[model samples]
Target chain A: MAERKVTVTSEVGLHARPAATFVQTAAKAPFDVMIAKVDGPPVNAKSILAVLSLDVEQGDFIVVSAEGEGADELLDQLVEIVSAP
Target chain B: MGQVPTAPPPTLTGTGVSPGIGYGPARVLVLDVPEPEAGARHDGDARAERERAEWALEQVAADLEARGARVGGEAEQVLHAQAMMARDPELATRTGELIDRGVAAPRAVFAAFGTYRGLLAAAGGYLGERVADLDDVRDRVIALLTGRPLPGAAEFAAAGSGMGVTTPFVLVARDLAPADTALLSPDAVAAFVTEQGGPTSHTAILARSLGVPAVVGCTGATAIPPGVPLLVDGAGGSVRLSPPAHEVARARRVARAGRAVLPAVSSTQVSGSHLFRRGMTADGHAVPLLANIGGPRDVESALAYGAEGVGLFRTEFLFLGRAAAPSVAEQAEAYRAVFEAFPGDRVVVRTLDAGADKPLAFLPPSGVEPNPALGERGLRLLRRHRDVMNVQLAALAAAATKTSAKAQVMAPMVATAEEAEWFALACRTAGLASPGIMIEVPAAALRAADLIGAVDFLSIGTNDLTQYALAADRQVGSVAGLQDPWHPAVLDLVAATASAASGAGKGCGVCGEAAADPVLACVFVGMGVTSLSMAAPALPAVRAALIRHALAQCAAAASAARSARSAVDARAAAEAALSRT
Candidate 1:
């Protein structure tokens, strides 16, 4: 599994459109993906409810982990989306 | 059930905040969605119950997507985003989990959303706003399960129905949320009547901006049965339920005449022959007409409608909804865009006016405030976050050097001479020469002389002045009648501030919703206001009204209005004086 921690910086954290967009992107990957608040249990990244339930807000750090052929590339893409304003 | 008796036709009165008249079939908006019965269990068929819940969720999601497809642009984007929330896989799984526990579908769906709602509400500000959108989705699903029609969802459903209303319908509601109102257009909703909200409420403001007739604070507005014809006299603040046919005919005639005159005054494109000139009274007193703009995008319309300069450039657009403040260079570029729009003209930029009703995520208020209207906002927030103010001032200074337009910066919510002096010194230190303060607070207006001594100029935000002067919350519709700028007490403050600015040999400008009123614009000029800044579309009417009267006439009207006992009386006095001259 490839895991990376990044801070959410999109002002509204991962709520509403941002969270939905994030999940839609993660679902497109052909692998199992999960996200968790720092030191919290990981939830399915493809689940909008699970992503929102984590309650990741701006300036809060979260870890993204996935196991697949392109796990490293997928984590990088997810990190970029979460960090960009 | 017993047959309900036909009640006598009633006339509900409210504060008429927007002008004009409209009549159409009442389309009462329902806002509240009741929670399903708690812990209500389904029959032991777990598989069947889960399938029922899934079907409702899918139906709601499909309905939202259909609405989004029907209403393109921003509304479509918002609706489509909501559909995603409806189809949230995690929400479905959790809801299924609850159904498996023998909970009813509606209760299960409600409980599943509640878990996420707590987290978002705690985050506050922008995230807090999402809670409403989330609740909206939840309500739609629950409504589906309970076989009840959703409130705001009815409009979309109606539009999707093949047999929608051919004529625009009158929107009647207990109150309108700004978010919901943003999606409605004048073409769809002919007028607005709300049981709550004052003249300064969001419903009233949106009506005026959309050029729709509106009555706010209307008693029992929500009781008007949907599909019953309603005659709304927006200027009179009255709604006649099931008005006589003859009355409707007469009102339609008057409304037609009113509409015919509106385009001549509002649509600059339609009146292509209309010349753009400096704003002046008939007696040749120059009252510079300026536009109150949100961002650079509004400049074209402002200039098209003959805006001599930018009067009040609200910087909130750049700061709101952002996780972090923009870099000085980025801020300067945005400021430069507005300056470049009007070369050799004045652009008075108001520093970020966030807090109270318009809170920002990055700069949240310290604690829960009982009354946010009285909380630390505007300059007070900047004072706490000095770096924010410094970067903004630096950006303004940088932009000024790159453009020909005269750049003037002002601070909002300044209460004392000390704050004025501090802001002035900071602007000077940041290499900006022109620094001013808004006279919004009653304290600032009362001691305008001392503050004017510190700053270069003064701008009166009558909206805040009226709210502060009358001790009424601008956001509260119940006390909206008290939030009138025409109140003698509010006029007294304006006169005091203008007189002080005149005495100090500094320019005084009016840059609030009050300036948009053509009659009040003349009153402002008579009170020694050197400039009037308002929304772009309102410029032409104010110009025409000013050109129709001389300086002496305006001064007389202003004096007459100032002596009146109440807001209504003051307005009548001003109108009588202006017409008599």
Candidate 2:
């Protein structure tokens, strides 16, 4: 499994447009992708409802993980989206 | 039936949140989306009911996307996100499961949404607010299933059609939900009148952003029958119902003339227009008009509105919403950008002002106090965290060396001359020039001469001065009326501060909401305030007002205002004096 921990820097955190874009990107992955708060249970990253329910805010840290080829590239893309202002 | 002669409809009054005039037919927004019955059950065939629920959600999602495409920009992004909520897979699955258990489609959808609503509401703050958006989506789906018209659907459709309607509507409502306003544009809604809302309400903020005239907290506004000709004066806070044809014509003529007199001034054409290029009185006393900005992002609007320079460049933006203070290099980069925007012009940068309403995560207070407002904040917070203050000062010094902009630094919430001296010495050590201190505390204003002697200049923050002098908490709504800077007591403090700065042969500037008021701008100049700075959008009006009156008239008006006992009387006296020769 390829995993990366990134901080959400956008003022609204992982919600609104950012959450929608995140979920849409995860849906494009060939295999299942998972996301969770540090030390929290993982949930399906492609589910918009699950991501929003996490209620992640600005300055929060979250872990994204995926297994298979191209997993590193996908995780890198997700990290860029969350960290961009 | 023949037309019967009747008395004129009564005029309704409310607080004017946005400034403009609008005349149009009343279109009352009815929010009557009924909740689906909880015990409702589907027929024996659960599969058909499940398909019906899925179909309804899909239709609502497609409709939202269509409206979003028509209203491009920020509104479009909002509608698109709402559409996502409508087609959420989790929502669809939950509804399908409920339908399989013999629950009706409408009831199943409602229950499914209710679960998410509870979770968002429990999360509070920004997340809590999203519950409203979720509820809006749920209401739309249920309305479709029950065969009822979606609330505000007609207005949304009209706004999205983009076919310039013959006469725009003056939307009258009890209060508008975000969904109702997401698709509305200025062309479709001439004005907005609501029965409940204050100056800071969502409706007021949205109306101002869209530049649409709006009146809020209007009693009897929703009672007005639809299609009645309503004339709204947003500045005057009056809504005249079924006004005479002649009166409406005259009002429209006046509004048109006002617009013609002050077309939006752009930076490219500012040099060509002599009247707006500089802030000067009729007698030609120059008082440079500046803009109060948060950071570099605001430079474009400030330049667009022809800001001569930056009056109050708040440095707190760099420190806010962060785990720690930004590095010196990062801070210098941000400051340099702002300084570069206005080459050869003054840029007064206020140091990190966090505490009270705005507390930083890294910088904690010494102890818990009964009142945070009166506790250690601003300069006091920086004093304890000297490393933080030194880094900021070094960054300012570094940025100033790289730009031609005349960078000036100041400390906020300085109560005594000793604090002013301490801050000034620190700036001098860091090689920053002309360090000043804000006169927000009553003690600072009362002993302005002593404090002014310690700094290079003085900037009067009238908002905090008013709050401190009148013993009124600015955050409390009930005490908001007391927060008026026009109060004679607050005016007295301003006069003292400006006089002290002048006595010390230093510049004095007013950088508060009070300066945005054109009439008050003139009065500040009269009280010996050498400069006026406000939000960029208010520059044109203040410049226009200043150029219409001479320095002597403004002084007389200031004197007249000081003699009055109350804020209302003071404003009236000043207006009366300025009107006279």
Candidate 3:
């Protein structure tokens, strides 16, 4: 099991569409994916409720981690997604 | 309603904004102040305490004077007033009296603050009761506070707050707040005259919506007490007490004559040829300038301004100020009307963005409120209130088939790649075309390359982008300097979104303040923003600016603007481009 902290880059943050997006992407990944507010603990990314619990806004740094193949790339993509601009 | 209308009231002397005399009515108004509770204990110990409180206030006042001597303007006055409260002898004397009575420090301060504050408030209360003359209230107030009789109304504006009116009278007030505007019955009041309020203040918004003329920042406005003949020229931002008979006669004549001419634009001004031409830059470069309308009234306004199209049709207002959900049929009728109004123009309708700051009157505002800016609004609101979203979608889908106008639906406050997918899926299920998301969130910008693929077009809402970018409110003066569109952070975000959309051969436009700013117009145009939507009135200047600058010059201008520190700097850099060939 692994987790990497990342920021939410979308203008509105991770409360709405982005949170749902994270859940969808996390569900597609090979390993169990989780995201959390940087100041908080990791939670299931697939669950919209859990993802939103992160309260991630644009520029918020949070951690994303998953176990299994391509988890690193997944984290990288998630990071890119969070800190886009 | 009779006769070709005699000349409007003569040109009235009022305050000046940029400097100019304009004719308007004599709006006599009284001020409304919150009434304070009565009853209190007055004694010697209380006197000593009051002295102490006065001393404390003096100290604060001294401190403000010291600081104000160095810094001036609006900020100085703001700080100085606070200092004045601190220096006020009454505040010190009252507090001291309470403290001597064995009251705790906080309690003593509050108690003292209350008693003395109450005295002034009582006077204000008395003034409110009289509503016509404040001289009586002023004398009683000054005598009570300073133990000295006050002067006459010769220095009237200095005596007390100004008068207020709900009817068609020149309502002179020290300031106009939300409450003040609320008291103005449209039928009774012809216009608003305030000694204070910025162009962007709520008072201004409300006043404009009511079609009432307004003048702000009038000095010594309270001079014209209620009933004493005075003229209020809101257009000139001035007030004159007892204008000579000649000036009054001249005003009435000019007003009657001016009535024949369109004094100002109306809400439904989009009907004329002024809006007929494609809203483009002077140089032949086309930039769509759409209007973000609220409802029928705004639609009427948009059409009046000849808005190219409705970039954002906010659906939230429909759910608010109403008891129940607007049914699919009702919703369709409205949407159809909008589409019908602009047969060839595009109407990119945004789904209900009602949650957080904007709650649905008919439904439970998604209880998810810790951080509404980052919470369920826009698409999430739709998911939470699917029935509402479906009804809107169904309406739009049906309306689309019947109307001549093009309808492209957009979702707001979207944050992720998958959310775009959901929006796409939902739009498809509803049989709607050109479904997209508002890339107002930074995360959405990061996945822009992918997100744009999920939608047909992109419209970046820069207002929220700037807020989330610097974690600053648009209204806070202290942090206003940092709320720059040119900030590397913001520019980078906008650039990324633009780049992604461009790479995918998709269209992207910015429909925020920056888009409509004359100075930033070229910069945005350079950034490849397909359309720039702003307040309708801002169209001409922005159009003029765009026409002066070429597209090739725009890219470099954007880059130059990107390096600027604030909006001011960005504007300077953009303006610099116009100076050249």
Candidate 4:
């Protein structure tokens, strides 16, 4: 499994346009991807409803993990989207 | 349309938030999306039921995407996000599991959405607002499964067509949600009449922004069957159902005349016809008209409406929806933009009015109280967090120094002479030339003389004053009738504050929805209010009304209104007094 932790840097946090972009990208990945806050249970990354329910505000740390052929590449892309200013 | 009624059409009254006249066929928005029965069960074939549920969700998602594609912009992004929620994989999986347990498609979808609903509602803040969006998606899928017309689908379809409905129509509803009005266009809908909403409600604000005539809180608005001919007078707050031909013709003529008087954007020539250039009475009482603006973006409209200056420059925009307070330099730049727009004119900047309904993430209250409105807010919150207030005052002073415009600062929700003195001293310490406090609390108005001695001027925020005085929440639709600023009690408070300011020779201004009403504007000037500020769109009519009446006539109207017992009676008495030229 490829895992990475990234702090949400966007002013609106992991919501609105950022959340939509994150979910759309994760949905396109061939492997199963999951995400959660540091102490919260993991939820499907491709599910906008689940990701939004987590309510990860700006400056909060979130962990993303995926296991498959392109898991590492997908994790890097997801981290880049959340960490972008 | 609905068989010309044999009876004389009834006239419904509501609060007029936006001013104008419109006559059109009524198109009532139906939002009766029924919930599925809790125990509703599918047939023995679970596979077929699950496919039906999945198909309905996909259909709703596709419909949302198609609508988003049609209206491409910021709205498109919101609709796309809603579509994503409809297609959430976890949601589909959960629904399918419920269906396999023998629950019907709609029931399964409802149960699945309910689980996430609880989670989102618990999260609160920005995520809490999204609960509505999530519910919208869930309702749409269920609406599709149940074979019912989607809520707001007709309105969106009509708005999708570039110019709007083939014939303009008056939209009637219980109340409008954000999704219901996502595609609303000014040209498409002639007017708006809602059964519920106060002057500050979403329907009122949206109607004002669209420049459409609107009447809210009408008793029987939603009961009016679709396609009935209706005549709406937004200023008079009247909706006449199935009006006679002559009445409709008269309304049309009045609307045309109103449209003709709009101030030309490029004209600098001030003549008798261009009366909106200045605010004065028929006998030459100079009461400057200003604009109540949210930020720098509204400066152009304020200028277009011939505003002398900005009466209320709400600084909360800079602090809201952010994790931390903006840096002093960033705040200064924003303030400077507004000051530069009206050089040589006074821009009254209101310090942060956070707390209560508008709590900031960085500045939470010391403890949760049963009532936030009466709790730590405005100056109370600032006193506890002096660092935030000091930074804001420093920004205002820096911005004022950089521009030719005079910057006068004020504090909101100040309730005592001591609090007013504290705010005034803070302003002077920061090098701000003038400091004032808003008379939004009855306590401040009752002791206005003492409060006036502590500050340079007084600005009455009638919205809050009415809310506090009558013990009515401004946002609650059921108590909207009591939110009228024309109530004798509310007017009495205004008179007290204005008289106190006049006695001390300090400028007293009104920057509230009351100032937007033409008749009320005249009465306010009569009561010795030196200035009136409101939304830019309302400037022309108010200027015209003021120019037609002398200061003595306005004073007579003011006294006549104050002698009345109820808000409705007060308005009628004032109109009668003003018309006796």
Provide the lDDT at B86 for model 3. 51
Lowest summed-lDDT stretch of 10 residues in model 3 chain B?
A: B125-134
In terms of docking quality, how is candidate 2 classified? acceptable
Which candidate number has the best DockQ? 4
lDDT of 3 by residue, B1-581 (tens): 01221322322333332211232344434333222223333454655645544554454456545544444433243334344345333344555655666553334554544443443334331111211222223222323343332322211221112233223454556565342243234444445556554443344444444444566655445444445455545445645556788986776676556543331322123234454335554446688878766555566666655578888776664564333467888888888878888888888888887655455434444353567666666787688778878888998899898987889999988888888998888898999978977888888887799898889999988777887787875433345556566676888788889899889998888876566567676777788878877655455556556655678788778888787777667667766865677
Query: What clash pairs does model 4 have?
Result: none
**How does residue B422 of candidate 2 score in lDDT?**
99
The top-ranked prediction according to lDDT is 4
lDDT of 1 by residue, B513-544 (tens): 89999999999999999999987767878887
Interface RMSD of 3: 24.6
Better of 2 and 4 by TM-score: 4
Model 2 chain B — which ten-residue stretch has the worst lDDT?
B1-10
TM-score of chain B of 1: 0.79
What lDDT is obtained when candidate 1 is compared to the true structure? 0.83
Give one digit per residue, the lDDT tens place, for model 2 in A1-85.
8999988997668876788889888879998899999988898888776788888878999999999989999999998889878
Q: Could you tell me the fnat of model 2?
A: 0.52
Docking class of 4: medium
